[model samples]
Target: MLAKIIQEGLLNHGFHILETRTIQYGTQIRLLEGAIINVYRTPKVLVQGKSISASPEQLRKNLEYVLPTRITVWNLM
Candidate 1:
């Protein structure tokens, strides 16, 4: 549900979808920018990457709009 929405949002915004797989917790979406978005079964989302904060404003806003309240962002620079 949420994961699918995020995926579509990213795709519509021109972010390449590298891969999508199911993990122990939930669904994981990998983007071309080396970012990984984990959508947990508990309705939590974890976004990790070095370039997340450094990404374009539109991309950042898109993420902010698409992601839910239970979200965590990690900058792995």
Candidate 2:
């Protein structure tokens, strides 16, 4: 459910979906710009990639649209 919403949101934001795989826990979506989105069944989403931080405004907006009010950002540097 969440995965489908995210896929549609990203696509509407002009992001090209490179690949999609159903993992053991949930769905993994790979984007052309090197961004990987992992939507887990536990209502937790893990977004990784250098491009994510520097992505366009619309991309960020799409993320915010799906995210809950409480968000935790970790600087995995």
Candidate 3:
């Protein structure tokens, strides 16, 4: 999927990536780009949506706050 996305993007913009590099610093994993990105995730957090219907569970896990059993906060963001 990543390769397809890059290929399509380059094609759409009339720009070609004639070269790819594997960027690796050390075993600690500092940064990776292009071909090297396959080794590490490019995103830190994945946020899809937010809601207020499941807040009780979320708050309980996140803030350790107690919420009534009947209350929930679904992802709505």
RMSD of each: 3.1, 3.6, 16.3
lDDT of 3 by residue, 6-66 (tens): 3454345433334444434211111111111121134121112332334434423432122
What's the TM-score of each model vs. the native?
0.72, 0.70, 0.26
The candidate maximizing TM-score is: 1
Please give the range of 10 consecutive residues that has the lowest summed lDDT in model 2: 68-77
lDDT of each: 0.73, 0.68, 0.29
Across 29-72, the per-residue lDDT of candidate 1 in tens digits comes to 98876677898877788876655535555445556765675565
Per-residue lDDT of model 2, residues 1-77, tens digit only: 98898888778867789999999898988877666777888877777654644555545455566444353232111
Off by over 4 Å in 2: 52-77
Q: How well does candidate 1 score on lDDT at residue 58? A: 45
The C-alpha stretches of model 1 lying farther than 4 A from their native spots are 52-62
